[model samples]
Target: MKMQRRSLRIEETLVKAFIYFSVICVVFALFNILWHILSHGVGLITWEFISSYPRDMGRAGGILPSIVGTACLVALAVAVAAPIGILTATYLAEYAGKSGVMRAVRFSIDTLAGVPSIVFGLFGFAFLVIFCGFRWSILSGGLTLAFMILPVIVRTSEEAIKSVPYEYRECSLALGATKWQTVARVVLPAAAPGIVTGIILGIGRSVGETAAIMLTAGSSLGLPTSIMDPVRSLSLHLYILVSEGVSFEMGYATASVLIILIFCVNLITNLLVRYMITKRMGAGAH
Candidate 1:
C-alpha cells in the first residue's frame, strides 16, 4: 500500500512538472514571436503607413486597402455563416434526437472540420467563382470563408445547446411555454456566449486566410467599392510583400498589424464572453 502511494505521488509530481514546462514553453514562444515582430515592424507603423494606399506594387505607401478589404470579408463571412450555422445547430440539438439524419449530420460536420482550407478554396473556385458567376471578388471570398467556418460554428453551438441543463427546459415547458419558446427564451440565451465564441474563431480564420481568399477574391491592390470588386486582404498583402521582395520592412509592418488586429479581436471576444457568462451567473444568483 505504501509503495503504491509513493508511486502515485511520483506520477503526480511528474505530470505537474510536465504541464508547467509545456505552459512555459508556449509563453516563451509567443513572447519571442511578438518581440521579433514588434522590433522589426514598429518603426514602420506610422500614420502615413496605415492611411496611404500602395504606390508601387506594395513597395511603398500604406495598407489601407488591405485593412478595409479584410474587415469587409470577415464581416460578410460572419453575416452569411452565423445564422445558418446557429439554425442548423438548433435543429440538431433540440429536434433531431437519435435519428439517422442526426448521425449523418454529425458525420458531415466532422468531415467538414477535417477538410483542408486549400480544398475549400478550390471548391469555391470551381463553384461560386466559375459556376455561379460570382467571379474573383469579395462576394466569392466571403462565401468561401463562410463555408469553411460553418462546421466550427455548428459544432460549437450544438455543444453549447446540449450543455444547457435539462431542468431549464423542463421548467420552461412546465410553465406552459411552447417548445420553441423554451428554446428561444431559455436555451438560446444560455448558449449565446459559446455561439459567439465560435463566430469569433471563424472571424479569425477569415482574417488570417491567404491562399483561399487570394484564389477567390483576387489580390487587387485598389480599394473595393462593391462585393463584385476584387480586393487584397492583409494576409495576402503581407504574403505578396514578402514573396515578391517588394519591401521586407513593410512586410514586417503588415505582419505586426495583423498580429495586433487578431489580438484585439480575441481580447474583445473574451471580454464579451466573460460579460455574458457573468451576467448569466448574476441572474441565477438573484
Candidate 2:
C-alpha cells in the first residue's frame, strides 16, 4: 500500500511539474517574440508612420490604409458570420434530431474546421471572386473570411448552448413558455458568454488571415472607399514588406502594430464578455 501511494505521489508531482514547465515555456516564447518585434519596430511608430500612405514601395509612408482594411475585413466577416453561425448552432443544439442528416452535418463541420486556410482562399477565389462576380474586393474577402470562421463559430456556439443546464429549459417550460421563447429568453442569455467567445475568436482569425484576403481582396496600397473596392490588410502589408524585401524596418513595425492590434481586440472582447457574463449572473441571482 505504501509503495502504491509513493508511486502515485511521484506521478502527481511529475504531472504538476510538466504543467508548470509548459506554462513557463509558453510565457517565455510569447514575451521573447513581443520583445523582438517591439525592439525593432518601436522606432518606426511615428504619427506619420501610422497615418501616412505608403510611398516608395512601402519603404516610406504610414500603414493607415492597411489598418483600415483590417478593421473593415474583420467587421464585415463578423457581421456576416455571427448571425448565420449562431442560428446554425441553435438549430443543431436545440432543434436537430439525432438523424443521419444531422450526423453528416456534424461531420462536415468538423472536417471544415480542420481544412487548411489556403483551401478556403482558393475556394473564395474560384467561387466568390470569379463565378459570383464579386471580384477582388472587400465583399469577396469578407465573405471568404466569413466562411473560414463559420466552423469555429458553429462548434463553439453549439457547445455553449449544449452546456446550458436542462433545468433552465424545464423551468421555462413549466412557466408556460413556448420552446422558442425559452430558447430566446433563457437559454440564449445563459450561453451568451460562449457565443461571444466564438465571435471573438472568429474576429481574431479574420484579422490575421492573409491568404484568403489576398486571393479575394487583392492587395491595394490605397484605401478602399466602398465594399466593392479592393484593399490591403495589415497582415498582407507585413507579408509584402517582408517578402519583397522592401524594408526590414517597416516589416518589423507592421508586425508590431499587428500584434498590438490583435492584443487590443482580444482585451476588449474579453472585457465585454466578462461584463455580459457578470450582468447575466446578477440577473439570474435576482
Candidate 2 Cα misplacement greater than 4 A, ranges: 1-22, 272-286
> How much is the lDDT of residue 149 in candidate 2?
90
After superposition, candidate 1 runs with Cα above 4 Å error:
1-20, 283-286
Worst 10 residues of 1 by lDDT: 277-286
* Model 2 Cα lDDT, one tens digit per residue, 1-286: 9999999999999999999999999999999999999999987799998999999889988999998888898899999999999999998999999988789989888888888888988999999999999989999999999988999899889988997879889999999999999999999988988898899889888889998788999999999999999999999999999998989999999998888878977897788778766775776786
TM-score of candidate 2 to 2 decimals: 0.88
- On lDDT, the leading prediction is 1
Q: Pick the candidate with the highest TM-score.
A: 1
